[model samples]
Target: MNIFVAGMMMETNSFSAIPCTRDSFVNAMYYRPEHTGPDPEPAAYEQFGYRTFLRLARERGYGAYASLHAFAEPAAPCRQEDYESLRDEILDDLRAAMPVDMVFLMLHGAQMAQGYDDCEGDIIEKVREITGPDIFIGVELDLHGNVTTRMAEASNALVACLLYPHTDFDERGEQLFAIGERFARGEIRTRNHLQRVPMLGLYYTTLPHMMAVNDAVLAAERQDGIHSVSLMHGFAWADHPDVGAAVIVVAESGQGGVPDLARDIGRQFFAARDETRSLRRPVDDILGAIAASPEAGPFVIADVADNAGGGAGADSTFILTRLIERGIKDAALAMIWDPIAVDFAWQAGIGNRLNLRLGGKTGPFAGLPVDGEATVVALADAIEQEDPAGGLMFGIGRAALLRIGGILVAVNSIRQQVYDPVCLTGLGVDLSALRIVVVKSTQHFYERFSTLATGIFYCETPGSLTLDFDAGRYSRLRRPIWPIDADAAPA
Candidate 1:
């Protein structure tokens, strides 16, 4: 059987001011039809989902036609032309690579283009229009997706990662391919049912192993006739019509219990709504908590609001400035997305003391600029790190480590979250020596940072990806969704 693989990965934040351009997608991870093969071990930042699927196709002795694979860091709505150009490129390639038995896609369902609210669904339907009804379509999405009826209807199977930090890309890819293979071999025809629960909030506190939603999904999967189950926690930051929690169940055809199963799972999620509540605290509250604790071990602070993974600028100085003002010692705050600061540091040379204004350059959300004299402790160009999920290398362009008092700041030209420990160690800062470690990430830094720290705290600082979703005035989303309305009824 022939399998066609293509992907467009970007988690769009509707509130963000940054517009995702073609260059943004290209710079992050861009692959064409020419970039194909059985790459069992792709780069850390490479498109692992497509690569894994391609590897599985090779293992199954199937013809795999790989098309445009582009992924940008989470940002605002993609430009209409940029989105269309990339979408068309993939669609055109899929058309040229016709006669494929299956179509496998890697997409972040929360992605929004200028005029397209449901870009994933749009692409899926377009692919369906091209491939016709005969070809089996399977998709792998980030759990943060807003799974719509159209997305479920257009695809044979829609699978999302159970983990929020999304550590199971390869496993999910394999699962998606397996389901698609069942369709190709005429084994079991699958039908998908999506249940959108009226809930809008951050779910950062729940770990993968202990999440009730994941447990409910697992329970559903264990039921007879149920082939797959996924709970899209939903990107709360997005302001689209379908911007809320969702449950998707893929069951064997003729399975009448699928809808109930999907609803049951959604109900379970809604019942345990508190589990998904954000555990973000103000900076002062975090500091107080730290003072109350007796543990002298490293504390990993999650600067959630500034997380680049959630479309924040990743250059916010709110937490860093507070730490500095409070005279916090032996702490390292990383990956402040400041291109000018990095350039200035490079020009000043390493080991040289220079007066520099750092961070807060991305406008109001990033906080006021902090001006101070600091020593350039370390400098490195083309700094790259392995993404904890797949060990794929992502470049953090020209980096500099600036030391202000006892605080060490990791400044980079590239706008990226400090998802990995390498973002710090790559700059020659010994994380072991630090008393506190601040990462500009929401939850992606959990797996790595958790291992090194004695305590971890997620802070609700002022920035683009704020945990206080209710405060934002969203004109697109419908009324009565969870805490936003307080008395909202669950769907």
Candidate 2:
């Protein structure tokens, strides 16, 4: 059996001021097969979901063709020309590798180009046009997306990351391949139903109520004849007609009650909105909680609004400013994406002190740069961090660790969220000694960070990706959804 595999992932936040370019993808990743001509070997894609497909092919001794793997940090819509060039490259590769038994694509279903609202759907539709209906088509998706009907209808199987921190990337990737193998062998016909819930919000799987949703999805998958279940907690910043929570249930063709199961999950999730709302605390609110709580050390505070993974300028100084004002000591903040600061630190040399301005330079929402004399702690020319979202190694280019007052701040040239402690630890910032650790991420940072934190706080703020569902950011979104209407009912 032969399988053609490729991927392009970038989440778009329509409200972000920064535009995503080709360099964004190149800087993050741009991979092609290592060999040329006859027997091409796939590159050593460390920690990518696509690597799972290649691994399966190698272990099973089946033919695999990997082409044009691209990934960029979350930002505004990608340039149309860049999107077309990449999309066409994948199509051309798939055409040249013709007559494959299966087509597997790793995609972030929320990606958007200048003119394309549904990049994932567009790519899948185009792939379907090339591969035809007989070929088993399976997609591995990041659950934070606008789960559109076009994508679900065109592909035979759609498997999304089951967790918000997305620790299940490789697991879901393998699951997709297993389903594809079953379909290709005529063992079972794959039938999927995407049931949309009229609610648009993000949820942390670590929270009790949200964990219940994850448990429910997992339990549903273990039921008879069920192939998979995914709860698509749509990206709130991306404005689209299909932007919201959705339940996708993949069941064996001719299986009964698929729609009912999907509807039941979606409805239950929506009905529990009030309970999940408790996790969505605003910036000052969480800060107040920290001051009042008697809990001793190592509180993991998520700088949610400024999360680069959700298209926020990781340069925001809102939370830092608050912490500084409160004179919070023994705290560490990571990955304020400021290349200038990193460059300045490199020039100043480690163990030296210099007056520097950090972050808040992107847009109005970023607030002002934290200005003060910071002592450089450590520096690295190029560093890589483990990303739990896709089990991938993320490059943090020309990074530096600086201490301002009693706080240790990590600044990196790469625009990304801090996924693992190594992003700081490698640079000599000790996590075990800190009283508070603030990471610029929505939820993907939770998996590993939770272990170190005595408590966790998710703070909503006025930063780029604010959690306010009624923030007037939507124009293209379908009317009457969740907080947008409050009484909007899903039919």
Candidate 3:
């Protein structure tokens, strides 16, 4: 059977000031038909999904045709013209390759474009129109996805990663393929039930600890006729009409019992929603914790607010500024995405000290400009390493390393979630040797560093995707959601 596989994946933070252009998407790793080649080491999170699809398709003996996979660094609402141009191109290709039995989409469900509140829904609806409702369509989403009503109505089956650190991309792909095969054989007709929970919170600390959500996921997985279940914590930074936690259940009975299961699970999620509201710590508290910790191992403090994975500018200087202020020596930051600064550093050879104004270039959310003279300790054409969080198969792109003050920052030309030690170790900054290691990421980094770290702290700072949901000026999000209103009831 021929399977058409393609979709755009990027978590657009409506609050971010940066505009996601075609070039931004390309720089983050856009692979077209002919461009698919050897996978890069220290893989970007989304690339893991694309590669998993390719491997499974080949293994299942299905003819796979992929249009293009374009992901941008998380940012503000997508431009209508850019979204249309990209969506139309992919749709045009899918239409030309019609008569395919199934379509597998890889999408970041929280995307908000200028004219579209539900970009995934828009794409699926357009695909449904072309495929005439008979074709089996399957979708795989990030755990942080905002599963909307439109999304539930447009696809045949959908599954999201269960893990917060999202170490389940390949497993989710395998499950999607298994479900697609069942759909193709008419063995199981699945329907989805989606219910929104009244909470806007971060899922960084929820996993490996929260029993309610994990038990729900486990119970749903064990139930008969329940093909798959997902709890999308929803990217809280994304300011859209539908921005809150959601529970999605895919059941085998086409008889429409999915919503019952969905509500049951969603209610359980809602009961525990209040507990998941706040971040692990504010910036000051994080500094205090670091100062109090006596362990020699690197204290990994994640600057969750400015995470690039959640559409925040990775250039935020809040954590870096605090580290510099407290005279925290032997500290390292995996990355700060300032291409211009990186370019300037590249021009200045190793061992040369140069005055640089780094980070805070994106917007006020990224914090103020950090001005300091940094010595170029080491320069490399490219550094390759395996992903720390990715089990056995993921990879990241070429990276460069530079030293600014006591902080050794590994800047990549590519935008990626810093999930592995290689993101720093490849750049000559040994994570084991440092007292503190600050990374610009959300939960994805936890899987890799949990074992090595003496302690892990998620710091609340300012950026597009901040934990301070109440502080954000949201124009379209439906009101009466959690923390936003303590007494708000679930829909």
Candidate 4:
């Protein structure tokens, strides 16, 4: 049996000013099938379950038809033409690969295009329209997705990554394929329901409360009829009516308590969010922790508000300026979005000194520019960083290592969060030698970074993707949600 496979990964941030354009899609990746087109153009990312699915297809003795795979980082609503064009590309591929037993997709559930509120839903719905419901459809999504009504209606199985660092995409990919196989054979009919928890908060799986919730999900899966239970922590940056936490329970058709269990877990998750709130600290407090530390190892500070992954400008100078003000020298802040500075450094070459204006170029919330006479320490055309998505390598284009006083900063032509130590190490900045390391990210940087740093700090500042889940920050949240409105109803 032949199974069709396609992927389009783009997470939209309704609050962002930048629009995700056609070039953005191409810059990330635009991989067409080898059979249809001349050599496909490669991008920095999109290695999601590529190897696993190949292994699975061989193991199951099934032929898998390849389609286009593309990924753009989180930004504002995608351009209408770009979304439609890419959607058409996948649809066209599916049409050509007819008589397929099943379909598998890799998608960012929160993808929103202009005039279309639910891009993932529209893709699935269109695929279903073409396949006529008989072809089993299975989807694997990032945990940070808006599990909408349309998506649940279109697909047979929708499973999200259980971990926040999203290190489990390969595992989840296998799970999706397994479900899709069972669905194709008509062995068991699935019953799925999405119960929206009326709240928006950052809850990482590493935390105790979320850990317990994940544990419960694991326990629930151990039951006879339940297939999967995933708490889709809706993307907070996306300003939509469906922008809140939700629990989706996919179970057998005859399962009795699936709906009840989903609702119960949703309520429990909302209640447990308060415990997750204490994880972040003020910049000053984090600095205090650094000063009070007895260990010499690098203290990793995660600049959460300015996380590029959540659609924030990656060039925030709030923490960088603070560290400079405190006269902290043995530090390295990485992947600051400054293309002009990088080009200047490239011209000057390594070990050469040049005056440069860095960061704060995106917006006001990005803070003021850090101006200094910086010495060029290192320069690389592209520094590759291993993504948590199964060790997939992503390049930080035209990277330059600038030493402004005691701090060695990692400036990138590509606007991206630091996923691995290679973001620094590739630029010749040693992790063990540095006293402080600031990564423009929230939770995604924890997996590889945790082993090297003495401790990790999630630093909150005034910028895009703020932790404060109030209605003032998000004006268009359709329903009353927690912290925003006290009386919002859950489930």
| Best of the two (1, 3) by TM-score | 1
TM values, all candidates: 0.95, 0.94, 0.89, 0.95
Worst 10 residues of 1 by lDDT: 36-45
Q: Using lDDT as the measure, which candidate wins?
A: 2
Residues 1-491 of candidate 3: C-alpha lDDT, one tens digit per residue = 77777768878777677788777666655767652222222233245446666666666777666777776667777788888888887798788777788888989888878888788999998999999877899999987888888888889888987777666777887898788888878788887778888778865434443566777787777778888888888877776667888887888766455677777777777776645445467777877877787878688888777777777668888888887787778888877887777777788877888898888887888889889988877665555544432353223443456676677877665555677777787667778889889888877787778889998887777566665665358777777787777677765
What would the per-residue lDDT of candidate 4 be over residues 263-381, giving only the tens digit for each residue?
A: 88887788787775677788899999889989996999999888888888899899999988989889999879889999999999999999889989888878999998999999888
Estimate the overall C-alpha local distance difference test score of candidate 2.
Answer: 0.85
Model 3, C-alpha of 75: deviation from truth (Å) = 1.7
What would the per-residue lDDT of candidate 1 be over residues 315-344, giving only the tens digit for each residue? 888998889899999899988988998999
Stretches off by above 4 angstroms in model 4 are 36-51
Model 3 misplacement above 4 A: 34-48, 51-54, 205-211, 253-257, 274-279, 384-405, 411-415
Best-first order by lDDT? 2, 1, 4, 3
lDDT of each: 0.83, 0.85, 0.75, 0.83
- The reply for model 1, stretches above 4 Å from the true place, is 35-47, 205-210, 276-278
**Each candidate's clash count:** 6, 0, 7, 0
TM-score of 1: 0.95
lDDT for position 8 in model 2: 96
